[model samples]
Target: MNESIKTPSVTDEASTPQMKTKCEHHAECMKVIQAILDDQATEAEKDHFRENIDKCIPCIESYNLEKCIKTSLADKIAKKPCPKNILNTIISKINS
Candidate 1:
């Protein structure tokens, strides 16, 4: 006889807070995810959000999308300072 291994199913309510529901609306979950990535969420909050995100596919995808946006913005903000000589040359070329 062949036996199948049983795996657990993840429901949003299983990981979400008592006040929150894993229903059709996801704006609240997305807010939690944003706070998580921003590091504004406390450890407990982070854990709660992470747990919920781990279970909710839509929330997980939204988190990943937001994370990428954060990464891209950070990259832009951390761009290397322009060299003075390069800037001067560009200005000169522009004026020519």
Candidate 2:
């Protein structure tokens, strides 16, 4: 069987994602990015973010930065015994 490989046309907008020239919703996108990075965003929100992230430079940068920071902190945290007073309070609350 013979087949022809189709090349994407330069003028095809669907083939190429238009890079955002200006980050107009930078502030709102940052909040969404933070929620996404922190595992707090809903699936719909995440889907929206995934769809648009590559098109927005600022949001992608924020997502990378926040992810890096969270990973670093998780690595650096040294687990220790909980404070006696706080532990007691938590236990009491749980028992109540």
Task: Return the top candidate by TM-score.
Answer: 2
User: Which tens-of-lDDT digit does each residue in 1-96 have in candidate 2?
Assistant: 446876667778577877875788888778888888778998888888988888987777778888899899999999799999999999999999
Question: Runs in model 1 with CA error above 4 Å?
Answer: 1-25, 78-96
State the lDDT at 96 in candidate 1. Answer: 100
For candidate 2, the lDDT comes to 0.83
- The lDDT leader among the candidates is 2
All candidates' lDDT scores?
Answer: 0.76, 0.83
lDDT of 1 by residue, 13-43 (tens): 4766453335365887777877888888878
Listed in order, each prediction's TM-score against the native is 0.53, 0.67
